[model samples]
Target: MSALTAPHLNRWLIRLHRPALFVWTVVLLGLGSALMCLWGPLADASAEAWQQHYACAPTGPCLYDQAAILRYKHIYDYATMAVLAVPFLVAAWTGAALIGRELEQRTAQLAWTQGLTPTRWLLSKLTLPAALVTAGTGLLVLLHHGMWWASEGRIGSAKSWYDPPTFYAGGPITVALALAGLFAGAFAGVLLRRSLAALGAAVVAVGALWAGVHQALPHLWTPVTGVSSLESDLPVGNGVDVSTGLLTADGERLPDPFCGSTINPQCERLYDRLGAVSWYHDYHPLSHYWPLQLTASAIVLAVAALLALAAFRVTAVRTRGLS
Candidate 1:
């Protein structure tokens, strides 16, 4: 029994999960390489194509490298989506293979007979994987951000910094999300002790976390208000829109009522009836990008910590009962 130690458990853990490690390595390398291409050559090619497209005369034959533009867009979309999917992948794999299988097959019980405490065992399960997930996910996000920055203003059709998928994939938020998924999966596995059931539950848990964050993101920070004349198109604010409506003379905000601009005779009549003088917009600007990202990431990390604590408690209760 003394021969078995934490190091031995960790080594055995890695050995038992070589296949997962290999697959994750492949995913990391593939995404990193693809994003690097986007950051350099692909973005350049697309930007050049757009330049040529704009340079063409209205009455002249146009022959820009449309293929290059499409290729960059396609690859960027795929890579961004893949990065966003990492959290779900982590949750599914961790729940199904890392903890659930051992518990279901009674192998985890056998390991406890050897000198490892349940707490130490759980730590061994989480520590190394958390490190790997953090490093890989962090690298991908950094690369994605670099690629996004390189394309800004250069690629006409490039996704905006606030685009939902781009924003999540290109920021620290995804790293926090991935970590949350890991702990969520562990908690589910310990609670369920069934691989498939845990897998589904873990995915659902992560999805719920993501949805909650998405809904709460705009409200996370104070938004700047933009007011414009009712005759102009809606207030010229272009970030995450919190709200848009008509503002009255007394500075009261009213719902837009889907009224068109004053160019429309009916819209002018409706505005007069409602006492609306101008359009008001509440939104986050580009300057608020880091604030939003950091706030959201911190919230997710806090949730991850809670999930981890819950997992440990569950493990403690179950192991104590067995003992």
Candidate 2:
């Protein structure tokens, strides 16, 4: 039999996954609606409450609706969490439904026996899922960025651009991360060939990768170091601080001088004695955000490519009879 063309393979894959595809479509539509709602009415409410919070002045002694301000913060945090959780959900689904269940049920053998090479079978499995995952996650991140920016300068907004969730969920890095999760999950499924086990392990693997990225993120870009007077607050630029503290008179870095309070006489003496601190700090500035994010995304996508290669290699070798 002639080898099946890519279009035929894609059609077969879609037919096989019609149920899953339908569910995902419904889920995405619901999420998209929620995102639009957040951008409109939610944003309006949050902005109003935030303005009220800042309107209070010492001379005016005004009272603001604390509940409304708190509600805005809660909505922002939870919405961010929902977007950030996409990778984990993709990883679990990939490990279980995409590959593991196929292996566990031995249905993959039917495709191979039908003159479909193992390589083609595996490629078909990964390609459609990868495209759908990348597109879905990309859309979510784009929506997240819109919502994040809407509340950014608002007084009561609790989200920080440099926070781990916000940083990864609000940029192109998010698409790269979702791809990584898919590849990692596919690898686990092929290796373990047990649906439940692969699902659990795939999630764990993705979580570990996420943690590693967060820890190494600051170092991904070279940091700027600077010094200032002891009296000045730590310089917070567009970027987040990797490390920051006061320096002694002799250029030695000191632990933060928790001198109790600025009003305390002792606190004043110690701060003054610290004597013109070269307030040293290492940080990625706002300008560094994209560079660092893109660098990290490239690394993650490279790793995902490697994982894909490995999956193809293993699938072909183990089912060499079909090859």
Candidate 3:
């Protein structure tokens, strides 16, 4: 028993220290650093713009610019996409290589004969890669937080940071999803025994899973809502008027008028004649975010585990036949 366990532990250690793992670490750190550096400049620009248009007073006539908020939203959307793509690509590449190459090169036979238990062997193979992925993703989350902090106080009239899907960004859910993809890819390699084919299968499988889960599930566990206060000239008398809204403790929308021409023809005819209008809107979730993410990831991981177990059984059977 001791001998068997020793060999298994050694294999795990060797796999963990592989060059590929180091490369993954470096790549993630580099990407995170680059993104973090960009936050300062973006925040500065946003702050400068805010100072120009909006008055920061304790109590007075204040307005939110919808157009500027939209512009920021657009920029953040693209930035987030680029940030997320890195983890997904890394997970896919690493996962495909995890078990695929071993089977392709027929190395599993020798490794099994070296007195390693199948469970330990499989765990060893997965441990380092999984850790690497988790660490990288954690760094990404940190970078996201930094950017969020930098932009927080600056954007007064903008939408809620959580409004855009990009703002949901990469969190625990995303890390779990990427890890599930890796597991699925590795399982594909076990079943297919060909690197390229396993990679293709993994891609298709993950894509389908992501699409299905995202569509079927709504924001329940992770409530993603965008809240923004916009102050624009309400169209009154061939011109625009200004308005504002308030939110109740229960998140109910309440309008509060500040100033506007009541007698203006456009204000009476088009602007609802309520002067400046203030109101709040709430976006309710159709479903939970965390539970669905977890469930979907679990399903993929279960499938991967089953596939690995099947591969182990097949290999053991073949060994017995030769004996």
Candidate 4:
């Protein structure tokens, strides 16, 4: 059995998952091709649509090709979603096929009886899938970064850099996120040891992780503050406005007395009475993107590492007790 030794276990694992490998290969190639097209034709098409929108809507109802706009939008949306969903996919498979099913079927115990240590088996499962998730998500993240860079000033409908989905897919964090999903799934499998339960638990875990990040993201970076006189138009800047309010001459912040264009006469007089002078905006400039992305990635990868450790330790203890 030297030909089928532990060192060759990864190969066996890959062979066992040939269909998953095929699907991942197809997905990567397809996504890469789609992104490449988006950098060129899709971007051009969307720009033209925006141009037509502006031209047609200048003084009359727009008659431009709404279908073209929608199609480009659909393409971009699907691409973003495909990249963002990689983590959950990893989690589901890891929970269902990697650890959960092996435990549920007692197959992992059989492997242990044949000389594979529980720790080694768990490591093998985590390592193979972690490598695949890292490579796959890394490629997609690079593609998205390139696409975003190439289409920055060109595509009118491309989301802002700090937009949650854009931030999620356009940086190194996506790779870390996929790894986290793998680890989370493994941990759930180890904890639950039931395929369906583990699957559900892992998905919920990843979703909670995502939601937590989304909530904390806006606060991760310090925002640049700008003040505009109440009579002036709001300053046009490309940044995420976290908070906006009217600032009194004494520097106290209060809700806009103008109440966002309703133009309450009483509120207007109250604004003059309270000495509210300017509208202030607290926002993150485009330059803050990397800081937020990296910080978030660091947090996620750290959590993933903890989960991986927990999985190994828990399994080691459980299997030792079983013996």
Q: Which candidate is the best by TM-score?
A: 1
Q: Show where candidate 1 strays beyond 4 Å.
A: 1-3, 321-323
- Give per-residue CA lDDT, model 1, range 59-154, as digits (tens): 969999999999999999999999999999999998999988889998888888887778778899999999999999999999999999999999
Q: What is the C-alpha lDDT of each candidate?
A: 0.94, 0.78, 0.56, 0.81
Candidate 3 lDDT for residue 128:
68
Q: Quick one: RMSD of model 2?
A: 3.0
Quick one: best lDDT, which candidate? 1
Q: Number of backbone collisions per candidate, in order? A: 0, 1, 20, 0
lDDT of 3 by residue, 253-272 (tens): 54644433435555334334
Query: Model 2 scores what on Cα lDDT?
Result: 0.78
Better of 1 and 4 by lDDT: 1
TM-score of each: 0.98, 0.87, 0.60, 0.89
Candidate 3 segments exceeding 4 Å error: 1-19, 38-41, 53-79, 156-168, 219-282, 285-323
Query: What tens digits encode model 2's per-residue C-alpha lDDT throughout 161-270?
Result: 88878888788777887888888888888888988988998889878888888788888888997666545555344466778777777777776765543356776687
RMSD of 1: 0.9
**Predicted structure 3, TM vs. truth:** 0.60
